[model samples]
Structure formats: structure tokens, C-alpha cells
Target chain A: MSTVSHNEITVTGLSIGYRHKKKEVVIASDLDFKVLKGQLTAIVGRNGIGKSTLLRTLARIQPALSGIIQIKGTPLTAYRNLAWAKITSLVLTEPIASKNLTVFELIALGRQPYTNWIGTLTASDTHKINEVIDRLTLNTIAHRKCFELSDGQLQRVLIARALAQDTQIILLDEPTSHLDLHHKVSILKLLKKIAQETQKTILFTSHEIELAIQLCDKMLLMGSDGFPFGTPRHLTDTGAFDKLFPHESVTFNSETQTFQVRD
Target chain B: MNEKKSYRLPFFLLTLVLVVGFLVNISWGSIHIPFEETLNALLGRPTETDSWQYIIWNYRIPKGLTAILVGAGLALSGLLMQTLFRNPLAGPFVLGISSGASLGTALLIMGASFFSGVLTQGLIGDISITVAASIGSFLVLFVVMTMASKVRDTMALLIIGLMFGSISAAIVSVLSYFSSAERLQRFVFWSFGSVGDLSWPQLTLLLTMILLGSILSILSIKVLNTLLLGEQYAQSMGIDMKKSRFILIVATGLLAGSITAFAGPIAFVGLAVPHLTRQLFNTSDHRILVPAVLLCGAILMLFCDLLAQLPGSAKVLPINAVTSLFGAPVVIWLLVRKQKMVF
Candidate 1:
């Protein structure tokens, strides 16, 4: 095997899906990609295209149907649960169980893996949490309850939680789904800044393909015919974006670098 | 953190109030002993009336201790259940623990009469009933947990827990139908729930269970906090779901089961105390909430016991009834005023 420099996550010939008892439902297959360090990657596709499933598979929230997910050159299954947690942090779109928790306390939970037996936050833990809060610019709302936060603010707080975990890789599932266009771009920009500044691998599943194309360093475009993984320009030049949605409904305008609604 | 300071004052006040509540519980009972005399008896000094000594040392003290154990155990288990199931409504009663104990006690005190009607009412020892109830609660919890492991869904487990309660309740009803009228009366007394008749040995056993359950709850604080993320995110953060669930179920069983075994399923305390504590404490971190439940539970139960005693009258209200009569309204008031039940 060649030494892939700065490769944080590498998936080869990967098949992702669900298994019910004996039957295997393969959602996507033959996915091969390299998620580089210090880069923001996006998984873009139509609904039910297994973009979230691919992210979950890479995060090991669920098992892949077949193929290898190598995290920093080691098989994902080879690491224990704790070891995997120390390397990759996950942010789901699902709401937290309790909204009574304050912003600071909730983010402090991301330090669970490193905390003491009783989950007490030591000096270092507090320092790390403060650094994350400051980095994410959540100072004003740090004392507010989660219920007090708006969707955009909550999304930032959730991202702050993942960052506080101090993992090398972060995976998010449709992070910008419910937010408006302004928030979606703000979150993407924040993610890009975080990935570049901290040298962490960040991948998120998003429906905002136009924003993703403008922001992401790499994109994994999911399709039934074939999954293409590359830089946005490379993928665009190869005419992949035009094949994303149905041409009758919408088409990609390569000239303006955006998707246009058809008449 | 400065926030830790704000909570510390409330915690200190709650502990102080608990101490005051305990002494008040001892001071005001069917027989009136002055607070100073009660303090003397508590301090192992001589009291003015010898009957006061006998009553305080022999009855009130043990009764108070039993109330504390029962209250703390139930409330801690309730908090554990709420956190484990991630449902604000979950508690020992909802999970069938109390009913399981009822079934065990029914099987022993009444089910035997169904077989031959040979054994007299006083023939069975108090210890035997306690043992039977403990076994019953643990067995049912074991079954619920086994299914939880298989299903891997918290909501389904909650439904299964309710179903177990219903099934045990049905069985208890059948046993009641077959037993003699005297046996039926005895079972009814047990169901009314008492904190008074526990002997020293029964108190010791209940104490052991409370100790172990509290220890387990302390150990589970980290896991419980993680669980607040919902199980999936918790699992993603390196929490072993099966192992954590098993420990929590065991802790809940020990606390809920043993209290039911000794005290006969005193209602309302387990479910109400956690909400009350959360309302006051203003945070869900189990590190604070666990010990907070211990004090809040004991304080609330002791206060309720004071009301049950009725101070001047020798007649006592059933603890189970008194708990609901007083506790339900307070919880309702809190929820109505706050516009939310603190989870």
C-alpha cells in the first residue's frame, strides 16, 4: 500500500446499506474516496440517495454492507469504541434529549471520553471548552439554556460540541437542512474555516449542492449509476453536477456555477 | 466555574433543610416529645420520660430511617429510570417494580392460602415477605432488561415495562380472588404502604440495598449524563449501550425492589422527588442530581410522614395515601407555575 500523505479517512470499494436479519439492502456500492486532512468535504445527492447513510457508515454509527473504511490507514472495525471516539466526532440533526442543559454544560459533555470517572471537568477540560466556545464565538449565549437558542445558534453550538471533543475527524448529517440560505452558507463557511485552521477532516451531508460546490474542498456526488468523488472543479468539468437532479425539473448552469429551475 | 457556586448554596440549604426535616419528623408523631428531648435521645443522652426514650429509640428512629431509605432509594431509582428511558414520565411505578414487589408479597401472604388455606396469617415472618418481594421485583426487571437488550429501543422497552406491570397486576388480581378474606385483608394492608413496621433486621437489609444502589447510581452519573444526548449520540461517544443499560436497570431494581420489599411500595415519592429536586436544583447533571435526590427525597418523605402522623392524634393515615394526597398537588403546582416539568 502506498503512503497516502495527509489522508485522514480512506474508503475503498465500499458498499453501504441496511441489513434486516438475513437480507441485505445495499443503498450504494463501489464508493472509493480519500478524505484529506484540513479540508471540508460534502456528500451531495437527491433525497434517499444514501448520503446520510454513507456518512453514518463512515462514522461507524451503522455497519457498512461491504468494503473497507480505513481511518488513518487502519480498518475502522479494528479500533475499540473508545479509540474510534477519540478520533472521530459526530453531530446529528436529531435534537438532544434534554433542553434544560445550559450551553456550557452541554458542550462540556463532549469531553466525556477524556473526563474523570464521575465526568468531572478538570482544569484542562474547562480550558478546552472555553477555547472551543471562544473559537465558535458563543460567549454571549454560553449560559443560556439550549431551549433559548435558535436553530442557527443551536447548530453552531452542536458544532462547538464536536470541536470540543477534539477529534481528528468530524461527521455531520444534513447539518444545514432546516436553516435558511444565510445560515446554511454561514455554517458552511464556519466549517470550512474550522477545517482549514485546525487541520481536521470534516464531512457533512447536505442538499445545498450549489453552496457545497462553492465552499467544499472535495465533494462525493451520490448517484445510482455511479458515485463520483473529487474536487468541485474536477467533478464539474467531468459533467457530474448536470447529472445530479432530473433535467426536466432543474439543471446545472455551468456558466453561472449554480443550479437553475426549469420552466 | 461561577455557576458551580450558585448551585453549591442551594445544595447546602437543601441539606440543612433535610436535617431540620428529619428532626421535625422525630419531634412530631402520635406521641408528642419535645424537640429538645428528641435531640437528647438522638444524641444518646437521657430524656425526661423513659417512654420517650423507648418510643424515640425503638420506633420513631427506625421508622424515620426506614422512611429515609425508602424515599432515597425510590427517588434515585426514579431519576435513573427517567434518565435511562429519556422520558420525563418514567419512574419505578411506570416500570412495574412496585407491582412486581406486590406480586411477590401477594404470592407469599395470599397465594399460599390458595393452595391449602393451612398457614395462619401470622405464620409468615416479615423477613420472608421482604425476600419474596425482592425476588419478584428483580425477576421482572431481569425480564424487562433482557427484552431491552434484544429490542435496542428505549420507547419499546418502556412499553414492555408497562406491559409487565399490567401482567403482574392481572396475576395479583387472580391471587386475590382465590385467597381467604383474612388473606385478602392482609394483602390490602401491605398495598396501603407502611414505613413504620420495619424491624432492625429489615431496616439493615433495606439499608444495604440503598447503599449498593446509591453506589451504582454514583458510578452511573457519567453514563447518565451521556445518555442525555439520546442513546445513539451517547453510543457514538464511546458509551457501551448494553453495559450502561444493564447497570442502570440493576440499580433501579435494587432500589425500587428493596424499598418495596421492606416498606411495601410507598407511592408518589419516587416519581415526585426527582421533579421537585430538578425544579429547585435547575440542572440535570446527575453528579449533582443523584445526591440532591437523596436529600430531597428524604426531606419530602419525612415531611409527608409528619403530616401522616397528624401530630396530636393517635390515628395515622396510610403513608401511600398521604404521599399522593400531598405530593401530587405540589408537583401539579410546580408544573403549572413553571410551565414545564424539569427533566
Candidate 2:
């Protein structure tokens, strides 16, 4: 256990934003955090806080403006595309237009890094995909096309795809955007269970802050005061969650570790 | 995966259809050749009529093969474009390869017409038309490909392709206005499109290009599958999007370009066969779609050529017209019946 448990991700002095018209726009800067293996972490913030940007930067979809991102003690910049793909994968919020692909075929695509040029999955690739499918309880829908799946079922299948990549890290952007409260809780709970069982360092940007605080082992909070990275209870105790949004709309109550609406 | 075996039945069905279509196509032209005679002539056995053997060997067989090659090549290219662009409406000639070919012949025939008789109808050779069309399509394809790299958005690239095609077509229109009526009619005839009268050397060249394009497509099956998740996901999966886009564009160019060069702008088959194949297979897996599309394209083209032959009638129809006249209704019916068009 001691040999396997370590910091899977370490961000130092990370600044995330985009440049417009030759002007640098920094959404959040000087942010530092570490994600341990086998933990579910969340980056929660209000709208337009660059939560997706931070997640995308970690996923290597975009380059960080000025900072260091380390995955498994190696610099993210140093890892090549193929090597990085084997180490991490993404579950984007954008719906894929290819809704005609069956669940099994879509999930099987996660084996791209491991498969040959023609993508003929080996027995091991098949085993991994099937294992992930089983783990996600998708056997019933494996033969169904993606268009047939409900929002929740599709979310689970998307998670299954990321899991099937067999990477050490998984990054998702808004894994529960369009689902109901029940579906969101179930999806987040499923993510937590997979992290606990597989030792994957799962991190996702989400608007479901309260749910995330309850399910996540760690959280990185983006607020008006500054960025804070810690456990939910610790951040709650430090009043970091209190400054996330305007008090006029909602208030964070530390005693119950919940957000209360204002009159 | 178990899905591997699932496609074999469909493949068998399509192959059966393709074989029947090919035989029916080669047998029932204006001149009647019976089944026994066609089969015997194909097998190189002694036939009752020597003329039947010559017609079967020299005319019908080559024409049938050309139809098959043209169909298979255009369909494969369409699938590539549709997947790459992520557009359901995309077709093989979306890059304006056919239009570029048309412009090339226009420039050759009419570009010299008003200027001088150095390259008049008397002097213009079939080889020259083929070469000119090849160069024209290549030029337009080059511009589209160059834009393909610089532009990040695929939809923008699609628009650029349309625009580039329009620009060249506009150039052709301007060229046509200045030409003599006789040369204009000849150029118009070239645009009508045909799958017959190709010399052996031309057929061999078209075969070579289609074969090369298909091999490239097979090699890209993995990339295509990865791309179904979207380009960002594909890149996250270690696929270099620029390189993948370049490869896809080149393969599409090879197929669409050569077909237009040899067969003229044989339309609709490239655009519609993929949708038809999707409805048939009900999956986007290229492993199945690639082979399935090849067979389906060949079947549809052979049948379209048969219809164009107008069986037992002296008059023939332009293949370009027949493809749409015959294909659009089938595609429309399928899409409307299923109430879903697989993108």
C-alpha cells in the first residue's frame, strides 16, 4: 500500500486563462494543488471561473499559460502525446455527433493507445473493455447504440470509456451537466467507487459543489478570495467555501457543511 | 470482439448483391447476350457466338469493372470525408475535385479557343484532356488541403472547400462565355460523365489510384474510429489531428480526383452510398463500414450503369443524371423511413 500511494498530480504556480488581442486574461493564477492516488477530487467554482480550463490544462488538451503540471513525478510538458495518452484520458462534456456507434464499439475505442494501427483489439484489450463495462454495469446496454441511452446511462458509458483507457489519471469536464439530482448523485457516487477500487486519481470540474464536497476525498475551490485546496471539512472550517459566491444569493454554513439560501 | 463475426453475414449479403448486379449489368445491354453465353464467355469457354465473346470480353466486362471501381472508390472517399468533417451531408467531391477537373478541361478546350487554333478540337487529344483535368483538380485540392492545416475548425474547412470550388467554377463559367459554340458543346459533353470507352491504360491508372486510396483508408480505420469521439478526444488518444486530416484529405483526393479525371463527375453515388451503408449496417465502425461500403457502392454503380444503358434501347442516359435520378429517391426513402440519418 505504501509503495502505490503517492501524489499522482502536482500543480505549482499554475495560471490558467487565454490571451485575447495580445492581452493576457488570467482567470485564476498562483494556484497550487496535489492530488493523491485513489482519491476523487473536484474543482468547483461559479460560472466562468476557468474550472474547465484548469481541467483541460491537466488533461493536456491545452497548454497552461505559466505553471508546472506534474503527473506521476514527471512534467506534463515532457510527456509525448502517445505516452501521455497512456497515462491519462478525458471525458468531455460535448456530445459526440457519432451517436450511431454501439456502446461496446465506442468503449472499445479507448484501447487506441494499446491497439495496433488497424485498431484490432487484442484479447487483453477486449478484457479491459469488458471489465470496465462490467464495472460500470453496462452489460445490458453494451449492444445498444449511444443514441438509445438516457442522459444518465450515457454519462455512465462515458465514464466507462475513460476507465477503459486504463490510465493512471482521469479528467472529466462536467460529468453531470444535464442530469437530474438523482442521476448526478449516482454518477458522482459511481466515480467515487471506481476511484476507491481502482486507485485512479479521478478529477473533474463540476458545478455540483455541495454534492462534490460530500463525495470527494479532496477538492480545489475557486473563489473570490483565492484558490484553496484541501479536504471538504478543512475548507469548510477555514471559511473558503463561504467566499465562493455572493452572500446575497446563498450562504455557506460551516456547522452543517451546507449552502443555505438567503431571504 | 464478438462484433467481428456480426458483420460477416452482412458482408455475405452485400457480396451476393454485388455479384448479381455485376452479372445483370454486363448481360443486359442494348445487344442481348444470354446468361449462359455471358457466363461462358467470362469463363473463357467456347461460346456459340464469337461476337458475344468479343462483346463480353472487350466491351461489357471492362465497362462493368469500371463501374465497380468508380462506385467503390467514390463511396470510400465519401465515408472518409463524412467522418473527417463530421457532417452527414459531406460527399467525396466536397473538396471540389470534380469541379476542378471540369475547370481543367474547360481551360484546355476554351482557354485556347478565343486565343488561337493551336489547341482546337482537331488538335485536342483524349490524353491531353485527362492530363489537364488531373492538373486542375490537383490545384484546387492543394488549396483546400493547405487551408485544412491552417484552419482549426472543420466546418470552416468545409465552407472553404465549397468556396474554392465555386471560385474555380466561376473561372470555368467565364472561360465558357468567351469560347466558340462547338468547343463549348464538347466541354459540356465531358461534364456529362461516362464510365465507358476508357482505354486499357486509363483503366489501369484509375485502378491503381483507387487501390492506393483504399489501402490508405484501411490503414486509417483506427484513426477514423478514434475520430468519431471528436477531434479533441482523438488528439487526447494520441492521434495527431493535422496528420490525420492530411492523410484523410490525400486519400479522398486520390479517389475522387482520379474518378473525375477518368469517368467525369459521376455524382450522387459518392455522397449517398455511405448513408445507405450506415442504414444497412446500423453502426459507424469503419472496419465493417469500409468493406460494406465498397460492396454497396459497386452494386449501386453497376445497377445505375445498367439503367443508363437503357436495356434494349439505342439511346443511352448520362451516368451523372442517372445516379441522382435513381439514387436520390432511394436515399430519401431510406432516411424518411428510418427517421434517422447516421452522422
Candidate 3:
């Protein structure tokens, strides 16, 4: 909303895709969106939708076919690797083989962008990491190896790593995919609280549209045909939720903020 | 403050372990040298017996140091390769670097027989197989690096490395087929691995190469740690995966290639040491893992080298055979225990 600062991320006319054998397969094109600072933005779509691809593009993990993504009004390419790392961090759904890493060690890695050539963490860096671990409630298991943690705890550990990065914007892909309902709500609540408290922009994708609509400040709804972006209320009122599901049984109920199926 | 203390403890213990391991290595060998004698010799104390002093200085000291250095080098190389490829199984031997060194040594030993002048002029005597081995190691390393850059997936790169190793093995077999019995025996013996064969000069060169390569690997720890999350994550963190991969491969080659050149493709230590170190330290931060693996590798290799000497007998088993005896079971145990440890 209007709370978005001048330094917020702006994607203009973004055409995103990958090149294979000299052929461009565009996932989404002519996409224009502005992500407000300190807001939790949910990207919701059905299976095979370009939600993950769009998130990847926004995080600069994948190249946009032909478009401009600006951070603080500067083109994404203007910032060097360390500069970008300092500004943005990402959490993926893929599991990593961080066998030897403790939760604290893994979180400490978020300070890599600021660490010196020898990769030494300074006192202030350690303080920041401890603060994130405490923020994520990971202090009890901070000494536990990543491999030893449960899926829910590991997910929080990953978020702690991102928090330790001290970035303005964080992009996550299906962070709730593998979690149980309790963990899912906990992680979403954590993200929402982080967005509010830290003033950090968070863009995440999920198949749980109803949950996202309730928790997020704004939503980007992508479908097979096109994508529509707006606040959850605006999108729900404009019938954007109608196009999300294929069956006629389910309908989006704006007043109750819930999904219903006709008898 | 407590967290900082916890982190520092492992580093201090690792340093202590390395120091103790080095001393134990010096004391235990084929000859039953007492700890006092070894310590005296190490500290420049004169012994009453010239032969004891000579034995410690000329033979045991260099060989002992070589084992430590070679062990550290191979373990560090394995750690770097595994991190760079993001494959737990990836190592110099898995990637064909060892096979390449063997092939190069085969070429040198076989090619020398063809030129009588090469043997007569003492060219074969001075040339040393280590040089040929290093060349071969570098060649395969370059090929692997090139292929890794072109390929996007870690599994594909691992497969390509295996393929390169197979090709090198094929070439080595061809060379062995035509070589003279004497030359074949030499090549075969070298392939079995031995830390005892290195002279002082060769040991110095090996140390220098390994130290330089390790320094390079340490310098890139930040990039490597980022890479643990995955290449895409690493890229978003501002690391150019291509450049970092190139540096890592070259560094792996230097450490792996040099050790193979001097020690003759010692097996098990490279694959097992890093894994063991990772388990012992329970941390993937390369800053800790790197040195921890180095010390663990040295200790394991030195212990194996001692076993190879076969105390109180003239019979010396191939160092590789001794290492494999200990190494293979550790790897099997690791595989069996895989369910317990998550990587």
C-alpha cells in the first residue's frame, strides 16, 4: 500500500523465462508489480502455475527474459553480488545436505556477505546471529546439527538464516509445502510478524490461498491464462479467486473470507 | 559469549589433536624409536648413537612428515571437491584425478623403454614420475572443470567426472599392456601408494603445493558455504558460481594432483577423511571442516603408514593396501550408518 517506501522493489513489464536451444519459453510476460517494504506479499497459484518462476525472477535467482527489476530505483544488475546479497536473501523448498552444520552455524552463514575474505564472523555479526536465533525461537536447538532437526525446526532455522542476512527483501518458495498445519500456521505467523517488526519485504508462494489471503498484506494471483495482483480483498471482490480452481463445486466467499462448496 | 566459547573449543582441540598426532606419528614407525629419542631429535638434541640420529633425521622424519602432509592434502582436496560438486561421494579418485596420475606415470615408465638414450643418459632417473603425475592430474582437472561449467546439475557433473576416470583407467590399462615387466612392476608399486618413497626435496615441493592450494580453498570458504544451500541460492548471494567453481576445481587439482604425484594415488583417505571430520566436528562451516579434515586425514594416514611398515620385519605392505583395509570398512560403516547422520 502507501506504506511502501521509495526503496521498495519495482518490477516493470517483466518478461521472465529460460533459454533452451536458442528458443525462449517465457513463463510470464508484461508483468508489472510493486512490493511494498515491510509487507508480507503472498503469491498464490494452482499447480504448474508460474508462481515459483516469478518468485525466482524477483529474487534474481533466474534471469528475467526482457524486463527491469529495480531495487531503490536502481536496476538489479547495477548491484554487485555482495551488494545484492546484502539487500536480498532467499529460502528455497529444496532440502540441503548441510550435514555438518549446526543451526547456529547455518544461521551464521547469513553473515557471509559481510564476512571478510577469511570468512571470520565479527562480534557484531555473532550478536546479530544470536538475535535472529532468539527471534526465531531457535535458541534451544541452536547447537543441534541441521540434519538432526525436524522439518518444521529446519524451516525456522532457514528463516533465521535469512533474518541473519539483514536483507530488506526476502523471497521464499513454498515454505509451507512440507509442514503440518500447526507448523504451517506457525511459520506463516512468524513471517507476518517478521514483516511487521523488521520492516522487511517478504514475497512467498503457496498453494494455501485461503491462508495466504488471511495472513498476507497483498496477494498476487497467477493462473494459466493471466495473473492479477492486488490486495486480497480487492482480488476477491474482483472475482480473481473464481478462476483459481477448475471445479464448479468450490466458490470463494468474500464476506466470510472462506471457501465453500455447493451441495 | 557462551556461543563464542563453544566455537573456539573445537578449534583449540583440533589444534591439540593435530600436534599430538604429529608426535605420535614421529614416535611410532618400523623401528621402535622411543618417544624421548624422537622428541630429542625433533628438538635438535644430539644422541649418543650416530646411527639413531641418522635414522631419525634421514629416514623416519621425512617419511613421517610426508604422511601428515599428503594426508592433509588429500583430505582437503576431497572436502573441496565434495563442496564444489555438492555431491557427498565426489573426491579426486571418484573424479578420475588419481587414475589420470596413474596413466601419466604409466606413460612415462613405458615411454622410457622406447628411447634407450632416455635410460642411458639418466633422463628417466632424474625426471621423476611425480611431474608426469601432476601433469595428468591437471589435465583431468581442467576437463572436469570445463564440463562442470557446461553442465548445470551436480549429478551430471559427477557422472562426467566418473566417465573421465574410466577413460583414464582405459588409457592406463593400454599402457600397462605394452610395458616391460620391470617398468610395469614400478608403475604397479607406485599405484599401490607409498609415503616412504618421497625424498626431502620432493616432500618440500609437495608441502608447498598443498599449503598453497589449502590457502586458496580457505580463501573461498564464504562462497563454498553459500554454495551448500545450492547453486541458485549461492548465485543470489552474489557468488558467481562459474568463477567459484573454477577456482575450487583448480585448487582441488593442485592438492589432489600433488598428493597423487608424490604418494601414488593413495585411496580411502580422500573419501573417508572429510566424512569422518564432518562427523567428528558436526559442522559444515569450511573454516572448521577444512582444518579438522586436514588433521584427521594426517592422523589416519600416518597410522596407516605405520601399519604398512610392518614393525619388526623387512616385509612392507603397500601403503594403499593398508589404507584401503582401514578406509573401505569406514566407508561401509558410513553407508550403513547413513540413516543416523543427515547430510
Candidate 4:
């Protein structure tokens, strides 16, 4: 792994939402957070709580209404598509149609920004892709078409593609949503190992709050009213979990670090 | 993996079949020339007589070449449209550009009766129809591109194209109602499409335009592959989405419009050839798919033209009828098998 350098993504006073015609529907405002280098962060929320919106805004997939997103002290908007692609890689939640693409061909798409006009991969590009595939344990099925693989395996193939990009930051929206429990844990564990070993920053959203609390270095909890960001211990100590759920039905169990229903 | 290789062997066989088909087409005609005489004439060797030379040079050679070019062009245009719209049912006719050309031809034929002096004389009298058809195609191509800028959905664009075709069809019907019987017969014959109508000059023009457009598409294989994942994914891969879309649309328009202008709305070759090539090659890589589709299209067109000759009959069937007879059954089989059509 290369030595980690000034790896930081900062968002300040960021307001995100959609603007159609002249009207604007803001999802969240005054959101400020700094993701540190070489750490795994999980953004957790219930359905429709703006978790995906926030991730999209940060990744520059959608336009943010107000405020700035800076990577290494440079504004995100200043970078064109090619430069931006080199800096950040994204894994979307939708399933892609893999007609005749093998796992290797799909993963090679990550090198698009670096490829020339004819789309041929350089020696270094192939080496980096091979390294990523080997690291992800995708060597056995590397020749198989993506359509023949299971959902869990497909998810890994996508992540492998992101890794092949060799970017400083990787953002995935619900990377574990389609996996079984064992595959979920294994994927999360693999991500954690990647973050530490490669010294790359990784941010992903998930609804598995318990697993996130146990595995992530930092957590961002988004709720109906607003959002708060901190380490899991800091959030628990500040009673941030108390407001996440309704007061009537469920409560946060501080001892077991899980949610439970009131008797 | 070996099965994939074996599946591709038929494509080679198809090429052989097309060559034999072309030779057979050159043999049969009103002249009744033998196969050896035609071959010797084609090879530039001394023939027994000069009549066979004139028949082979003036008639059979240009006709055969036009069939191959038109077939390849229409098939390639259809493949591009299918990929662009992500719909298996989409084809060159769906865009209405062909209908627009038909309307232009109708206007020329109908206008000639009222003002004979203005219509009858030109730089090239017989060539006016081809020029008018090209102008018609260009006009419709411009309108569709303008509309595509506003509409983002693939289905919506297709519907708009169909609507454009219908409007052109309505205009052509009005013109047909007023045309003289002789002019109407000429226009109707053009609409059925045939390789025999092409003069040497028209064949040269068609060859240059179609080959240029096809090469442009071949160079765009990388962008097409990325687009298969969808526009958003393609954008994230550093492709300028708007620019890529514009270039692709222009190329498709040039290919489809020129073929329709030269040959009359030859259907099904564009709609069915890509699918057939996919089944034969078993690969989705555009680098492979594009060339395979081009060859397959040439073979299909040559075979259809051969069939159009009707062996020993005085009457010849229209080329469009022959192609549809071959193309429609394959499409029905594909739909019945429920093969997933990935754009």
C-alpha cells in the first residue's frame, strides 16, 4: 500500500435537495462533517431519512443547493468529469445488465478515466486490476459472466471495480443491502480490512445500526428532524440514540448496544 | 468456451453462402449468360462476345454491389437504433425518416404533371428522385435531433419518431391522390425498393456515405460499451454524455437516411440482423458485434436479391418482399423464445 497523504473530504454548510423549475425541496441543510483519512464511516438512518441524498450530494452525483464540498482543500465543483472520476468512485444500488461481460471486463471499467481513446488498458492498469481482484478473492470466478453470479458475489464484483479505480475516496450506497447475514458480515469485514491496509477512506450507508456501531470508526445518524455525526461511543453518551426512535414503542439498550421494544 | 467458438463458424459459412448467392445472381437474367462467361467477364479476361460484356458491366455488376452496400447499411443502422433506444423492436423505419423521403418522392411525381417543363429538365433527369429523397431525409433528421434534446426517455423518442413517420405518410397519401398514372407507377415502384434501379454514380455515392458512417460507429465502440450500463453510469466513466449521444444519433441518421433514400424503405434487415449476429457470434462486444452484423447483413441482402430474380420467371418480386419473408420468421422465433433483449 502507498503511504497515506493528506486524505480528507470536508463538507460545510451543505444544503441538499432537488430543484425543478423554480421551486426547491430541501432535504437537509447546514450539514457539516469531515471524514478523516484511513477510516471506515457508516451513515445510518431509517427509510426516507435523507441518507442516500446526503451521500449523493457528497459524491457530487447530484447538485447541492448551497455550501461547498472540498477534497484536500480544493473545491469539488472545480474538477471536470475526468479529474473528478479519478478522485472519487461510486457504487450505485441498481443492478446493471451484464450481457456478455465477465467479472474481469466489468472490473476493467473502473479504469475508464485512465484509458486512451481506443479504450485499451495499459500494463499498469492491468496489474492494478489483477491486484484488486486477487485482494478481493475474486480470482476463481474472474472469467465468469456477472449474470451467472449470485447477488452477494455481484456486489463484491462492483466493489472490486471501485477498488480498481484506485481513488482516494470510495462511496457506496447500501453496499450490503442484498446480501445474506454471513455475506454481509464478510463484506463489511473486507471493507474494514481494505480501509486499514490500503489507508483509503471508505464511506457507505446501511440500516444495520448494530453492526455499524460495532464495526465503524465513526457513525453519522440521520433522523427526521436533523442529523448528528460522531463516534458511536460519543453519540451514545450524548443520548443521540434516544431521539432516533419514537418514545412510545422502542428504546435504545445502552448495555447491549441494540434497540429493544418496551414491555 | 469452445462452444462459443463453434457458434461463430456459421457466420463464416454465411459469408460463403453470400458469395455463392452473388455469383448465382450474376448468372441468371434476361441475357441468359452462362456462369463461366460471367466469371470471365468479371475477371477482365477476353469474353467470346461483346454483348455479354455490356450485360455484365452495365447491369449485373452495379446491381450486385448495390445489394451488398444497402444490406450492410440498413442492418448496421438498425443495430445502432436498437442499442440507442434499448428496445428490441426499434428499427430505421421507426424514426419516420423513410416516410419523409417517400413524401418528397410523392411531391416530385405529383408536381411533374402540373408543371412539366420545370420538373422534366434537370442536371440529371432520372437522378432528381435520389437527390430529393436525400433532402427529405436531412430535413427529418434535423427535426428529430432537436426533439431529442428536450426528451430524455427512450420510449418517448420512439413515439415521437413514429408520429413523425405518420405525419409524412399522411402528406404522401395526399400527393398520391393527385399524381398522374404514369408518375404514380414510377413512385410506387421506387417505394417497393430494388438494387436494379441504382446507376453507377448513385452506387458510388451510397458506398462512400455508408462506409464513412459505419467507420465512425466502429470507432465509437468504447462509448457504446459503457452506454450499455446506462447514461448515468456512462457519464461517471468520464464520457461526455451529450456529445456521445449527438454523434451516435447523427451517425445513425446518416446511415439509415441514405439507405432509405437510395433503396425504398427496405425493412427488417435493420430490425433483425443485429439479433441474428448476436446469436451467431454469442458476444456483446461492439468491436465484434459491429463487423459480424455488417457481414451478416451483406449475406442476407445478397440472398434476398437472389431470391428476387425468381429463377425462370419473367416477373420479378420486389426486394422488400423477399427480405421480409426471410426476416419476419426469425423475429417471431426470437419473441416466442422470450430471449432477453438487452440494449
* Residue A108, candidate 2: alpha-carbon lDDT: 90
Cα lDDT listed for each candidate: 0.88, 0.89, 0.81, 0.81
Chain B TM-score, one value per candidate, order as shown: 0.95, 0.96, 0.90, 0.90
Writing each residue's lDDT as its tens digit, candidate 2 over A1-263 gives: 33423989989999988766588888889989888999999999998988998988888877788989888888899998899989999999999869988899889989999888888888999999999988888999999888999999998988898888989899999999999999999999999998999899899999998899899999999887789999998999899999999989999988888889999
- The alpha-carbon lDDT assigned to residue B105 of candidate 2 equals 90
Q: Report the lDDT of model 3 for residue A168.
A: 94
For model 3, the superposed segments whose C-alpha errors exceed 4 Å read A1-7, A247-263, B5-54, B110-126, B177-182, B328-339
Winner on TM-score between 1 and 3 is 1
Question: Residue A26 error for model 4, in Å?
Answer: 2.7
Global Cα lDDT for candidate 1: 0.88
Candidate 3: residue A58 Cα off by (Å):
1.0
How do the residues A1-263 of candidate 4 rate in per-residue lDDT, one tens digit apiece?
Answer: 32323547887898889887799999888888788888899988778778899888878777899998888778888889898888788887877744467788888888888987756778898988899999999999988877779989998999998998888888989999978899899888988998999988899999888888888988888877667888899888887877787768778887788899887
> Candidate 1 at B119: error in angstroms?
5.0
Clashes of each: 0, 0, 4, 0
For candidate 3, what is the DockQ-based docking class? medium
lDDT of model 3 at residue A212?
A: 88
User: Which of candidates 3 and 4 is the stronger one according to TM-score?
Assistant: 3
Write one digit per residue (lDDT tens) for candidate 2, span B31-145.
9888988899988898898999988878888899999999999999999999998888899988989889988999998898765856656667777888999998989999898
- Compose the digit string of candidate 3's lDDT tens values, residues A47-77: 7678888888888777889989998788987
Q: Quick one: RMSD of model 4? A: 3.8
